[model samples]
Target: MIKGAITGLGKMGISHAAILGAHPEVEMVAVCDASSLVLNAFNKFSSVKTYTDFEKMVESEKPEFVVIATPTKYHYPMVKYALERGVHVFCEKPFTLTASQGEELTELANQKGLVNQVGFHNHFIGTFRELKRLLSQNVLGEVFHFSGESYGPVVTKEKGGTWRSNPEEGGGCLYDYASHVINLIQEIIGRPEKIDGALLKSFYSKGVEDAVYSLLRLDNGLSGTLLVNWSDETYRKMSTSLTVQGKNGKIICDATEVKIYLKKAVPSEKLEKGWTIKYITDLALPVGFYLRGEEYSAQIDYFVDCISNGRKSEYNTFEQAAYTDKVIEMIVNHSKTN
Candidate 1:
């Protein structure tokens, strides 16, 4: 079994620890956090060793893999340290504070030939994979435009205190959530040739933007729009939907479900004055085509599979994560100038 260590014991970190601890192929050897209180609590639930210092945990446990679930600002240094020690790494989303840092780390990992995976779990969902397959099959012929959004209330309501509400700490809806949306778009339609965007800091007490919107132009003559915000008072909702206009058919996909509409009419169907709607279910859709799973668990399992089998990973690595960082930078910069 591969030995694993987790750093940080906050919500994301604790979740990663629990998932890795339960996996049969992994042994949760050690956990580290700056807070003794958090470390003590985790020690009570499992036999894994605990440490208040990450360096101590790494020195003592000597784990084959390390999960860096700390805040975004800490990711670069921590990942660099782990890579230097020859340990495989699986880090949380928004891999680093800047695209340059992300690129440096990606190069280091490649040089060391280490297994590194970033946490963009939405890509693993059956629905998304099927959507990719359909797009590749030209089911959504001649892609035109697409849009996506992820909105919710500020996770922490305090003033200038929450890490997510601070720009220095990589807080904001764009880096935290929109990164996923952007990554998905990149995968489906490829990278954008130019990006224009706007940001608003209306809701949060902090100066960080709570809402962001961007319009992108792809090299293939396709355009896309994205809106992500943390100011919504409604239920926590994340929807990644795309509508592709094609010659033969149109494909629409969202978190809830997927549908494909053929533009051509059937011979037996009568013409209608208004728009006609037809729904068809096909075997092409994967079974259990829903978005409900412990994403952290799936991410870790994929990383482990990559290490053990020498297989290529489907998840984003430092290179893709860095590209995402660059896109985000462009969006934020555009937002400022506009």
Candidate 2:
């Protein structure tokens, strides 16, 4: 069985650890956290070895791979360490502080032939998955543009001191919230050929942007806009919406379903084409324990399958993330110039 370890014990860390511990074909071997309380609590529930230092944990456990849910600042060092040690790695995003680090990690992982994946779990979501399929089927005839947003209240007027509030650590809403939609945009239409415009602003906190707005032009002549807000009090939970306009009809995808609107009447096995909605039950992969989605579990399962088969994931790889990070670098650099 492949041996797995986890670094970090925060909410996301716990989620990764849970998946590792429960994965049918893998052995959860070790865990690491700087907090004594965190380690002590995890120790009580798990038989896996726990360590305060990641290097010590790696050396002692010699795991086949590790799932890193540490804060963004520690992402590079931990990933670098694991990759150099010939261990496969699945890391959370934003991949690193800058695109250069992403490039470095991408090169290293590719050279090592290690299965590397980034945690852009949204790609595994059913509605988006369906949206991709429909787009590929040319259901829209000729696509024109795509726009989207992801918003919630994780950071507001009352919340600012955490690591998420720090630009270098987590990069505010653009990195935390906008990254999801940006990655989805790449998946659906491919990366933007050119970024037309951008607006990054901090409405609630001085250190980080609570809102991000950008206009992009895709290679296929599609122009799009994005607005991601993390300080919005209106949302009960994070809501994501993507609308695509085409020559014949339109496609709209949300968290639960994908809706299609055709200008002319057309009939398919399941869809009447003029207007039809498809929910996620049959489209998404099944899960034993779902927290917001089966995407997390699906992502873990995909990684394990890749490890077991000695192949690479077609989605959410370090190379894909590095490409996205290059776009991020361009945006940030352009923001500075303008």
Candidate 3:
């Protein structure tokens, strides 16, 4: 079994712990968190070791892989430490506070030849995977425009401030929310080479934005719009979707399903003219364990498989995530000018 450890027992971190604990290929060795309440719970129930200090846990456990789900500001140091120790790492996104930090870590990981994956779980979602496959086959010939959007009820009526309310801590709709959309667009569609316009708006939040609007141009010269808001009460939870328009057809995709429109028949895919819908059940591959979503387990599975098999993954790599961070910075800079 591949020995693994985790740090930060927040929502995402806890989820990772459960998933990794259940993984047939993984033997969870230890966990670390700053909260005594969380550590106490682990100590009471789990046989795994717990620590308040990350360095101590890593040094003592000597896990082959570690999952870091701490806040964005802490990602740089933790990821660097893991890489230097020759430990594979799976980190939660958005990658880092700055693009430069992401670049440096990416270089170090490459030099160390360690498996590194960012928790951009959307890439593992079946519908999006199908969307990428269809695009690769040129099913939507001569793609013209696209849009990426996400909305959630995270800060509907924000009063108190947490780390999420601070920009330096990777708060704000742009970093916390829109970064997902930006990464999807960068990887699946094309890299955003320029940020034409941007808007960071605050509704109930004091220090950070609750919404982000931006115009982007891809390296292929494809232009698109990005609209994300975490203040919307319409969505009980986060809802993200992507739309692509092309001469042949259009595609609308989300985590649950993908709706396709074809001007003419694509008999090979059994997708006729007009509209056709494919559900996640039909597209998602079965996994040994299930959690909040299959994509979560699927991404962890991929990370563990890559490390165990000594294979490098192209998906959700640090290099790709760093480019996403660069786009975030571009949007921020453009927002200032506007």
TM-score of each: 0.88, 0.96, 0.99
User: Which lDDT value does model 3 have at 210?
Assistant: 93
lDDT of each: 0.75, 0.86, 0.94
lDDT of 3 by residue, 252-274 (tens): 99999899999988888888999
- By summed lDDT, the worst window of 10 consecutive residues in model 3 runs over 155-164
The Cα error of candidate 1 at residue 127, in Å, is 0.9
lDDT of 1 by residue, 222-300 (tens): 8878877766768465555665667766656655456667665433334223233322233222322122353445566
Span of ten consecutive residues with least summed lDDT in model 2 = 264-273
User: Candidate 1: TM-score?
Assistant: 0.88
Can you write out model 2's per-residue Cα lDDT over 32-143, one digit (the tens) per residue? 9989998998789769889999988989999999999888999999999999999999999889888889989999999999999999998888888888888888878788
Question: Which regions of candidate 2 are displaced past 4 Å?
Answer: 265-270
Stronger candidate by TM-score (2 vs 3): 3
